[model samples]
Target chain A: MENRTIKMTTPLTKEKIKDLNIGDIIELSGVIYTARDAAHNRIKENYENNRKQPIELEYQIIFYVGPTPAKPGKVIGSAAPTTSARMDKYVEMMLKQGITGMIGKGERADYVAELCREYGACYFLSIGGASAMIANQIKDVEVVAYEDLGTESIKRLKVEDLRLIVGIDSKGRTFQEEQVKKYKISK
Target chain B: MTRIMSTEDLIPVIAKLCMDACYHLSDNVIGALKAAYEKEESPYGRDTLKLLLDNAELASKEEMPVCHDTGMAVVMMEIGEQVSWVGKPLEEAVNDGVRKGYTEGYLRKSVYLDPLNRVNSGDNTPCVLHTEIVTGDKVKITVLPKGGGSENMGTFTNLVPADGVEGVKEFVLKSVLAAGGKACPPIVVGVGIGGTMDKTTLIAKKALLRPIGNRNPNQYYKELEEELLEEINKFGIGPLGMGGRVTALDVHIEYYPCHITSLPVAVNLQCHSVRQATIEL
Candidate 1:
């Protein structure tokens, strides 16, 4: 792994993401949108509706989190990432909408991993329980849409030094899947 | 005699207990993480361990809670055999403490009153309170804040005696693999074997309170713990399952004799931040 920071745009390319590996530590300095169960469903519904003017999503990263409400003087309260498996069902939908990367904890389902490989996307696992540590990296946050959803509402987060690992790379190689094989010892 | 504790007397103490436990990782847990950091072979796992230590430091300095899930208040009490009181009921006193702790400490209220409705408990109260009467004259209070991620993945199996230790090892590994990164890697696994179904579950949960990295008293159980740890790490679950050899920090097993036909086993997994505290009043 060379010490070169590649400045890539969203709708990430297969060639660019392919170079990433399981141990490659990188700072995600980009526009990552926030969404969880509710927001994922809403986006799916919009696609089904064939809504005339749909939100453009070609190279966006969706962060799986439901942050606590911001205290009066704070930007957010303990904004940690939730378990990623919960969003397995909605990955394909979001990926189709041009989601190139995902940041969350845990592993994706087999189908989700397959879709990620098919679509040239990647999955990055952040440090769980380090919400306050991660929260320090966010430069700003705003509710771009879905204010009614409260904590689950969709928001745009401007972040820096948001450390993450390539849990699943673009070449369809997943550390998570490999882990199962490595550890499942046959009696 | 039914001794009573007033809301004022109980709330502050409970609030302080919660805040203290949330902000600071206990010495035993920290020691385990330190040891895990040293022993972790994967670069990614080592990095994750660094981040964990950093998080703990930041939490202490910034006065921030360790994890977002400060967890539901679980009060384990051993009331004194002698003492009389007048004030609020025990439940009310505990609830008052929960309310103040959550509200004042700025901790998240992660509990839902009704499992079905999913309505917020508001204060994280109506705690999972359990009490026992003992021969002592003082009250012994133990606060164990069980996080949802690990709690969600806990499993219990009532095995047949024929299955033996091998069965216990398989169930624990399977549960850990199934959990993956959900419970937060570098986990502390608690195994309870030989008790009945519910008893085993309790044993597993209580086992978490033991100092991390410390082996069980029984020599057989201690060796089993080492074997299980080696097997779990081989999975390369690493830190947060990013790929490495440090899947679990330690495997702590607590066991008791069971019926001739029953080989009950339970697995209570815990994340890096194993938060717990106790007070003898």
Candidate 2:
């Protein structure tokens, strides 16, 4: 199937996320927040305690990444999505607070898929290990918090033409589940 | 007297090769990606492979890493029995090489002090160095910058000898199915059949350093690799497991003899990134 191109700028709205289909290609742009294993641990800490969180979740999109440091002249070093499953434990909190979109690679838990459907959210995937290609899409990056965590620091980024696909849409149509349905039986 | 090799001379060579391997996608890997792109039936899979090709090109041209996860440096040092070196211990030399390469190359430092402590080592060091002494006058160093996403999918099983090749085929297929996109499709499958559990895994990893698409020198293992490759590609997990025709770039098997009572199988999946390099001096 030919993929449809999309332009997404955060804060992502429920309407925007709902419009995506599983496997639609996206040429995402605009501001996005970055966090990974350590950052998520911190977020869950605040979430369960009813403390003020790091970044606002309302209408925001979080990308699961821990980028390498930028070289002398580069805007950002190679930046790519980590495994999404690592953050599956925290998906409910983010979804409950209205995080409309997520970007990462790999499959997530079944509950995360159900949550996306219930919350009008979407899960997007990029080319795994194509960090140099992904880095070219970022215009700027800054560590907004958690600098002590080194590469795992929470950061903000401005990106342009970052390519991705909807791995799981709001309706709960997921790339992985569908792929298994198609191929596992045929062979 | 054994021939003398300076530690300083080998250090820089190892450093340069480590850095270069991370930045440069070797020709064989690039060739395989290109071939997969052309042969892939699904548009998404093709696009993914194309982006990887572009990533490799950009990395080499810009002298940046192909992936943000520059990877844990696994260095294999094969020193000739006739050769001796005056300098830091071999492990220290390997670590020194990783230290310079990760820092100077602007690569990500991923070594951790402890699994639970979760503290970054600051500079990527304490290389997983494998040393061997063979009959020669030279030293050969091979570096594999292994990524975590794919490394997490590696599995080893001790099947009784009765399970045999059919059992192995089942395990290989099932492992790829379970790994799906998590290990990254269009992956290089490295299989080590026989040996002890740990030895099987090491040889499985060593299998990855062989050029992609090359056959095992042994006729029996070569045929097994070919059959496994065919079975894996038929899974329809395409690139990134999104659905397509190609699931594996190649399946490589390396084997050693084991006791009559047991068969040990180790499967190591390397993502499409496929970073590796070798230098002989």
| Top model number, TM-score | 2
**For residues B80-160, could you state the per-residue lDDT of candidate 2 as single tens digits?**
999978888767777888899888888888889898989989998877889999998989899998889998999999998
Model 1 C-alpha lDDT per residue in residues B70-116, reported as the tens digit of each score = 77778787878774545778778877887787788877777777887
Chain A TM-score compared with the true chain A, each model in order: 0.87, 0.94
- List of clashing residue pairs for candidate 2: none
CAPRI tier of model 1: acceptable
TM-score of each: 0.89, 0.97
Off by over 4 Å in 1: A1-23, A41-58, A69-72, A144-150, A178-187, B1-4, B83-85
lDDT of 2 by residue, A54-161 (tens): 778788889898777789988988989988998999898888877888899988888988999999999999878889889989998988888888888888889897
**iRMS for model 2?**
1.8
Chain B alone, TM-score of each model?
0.92, 0.98
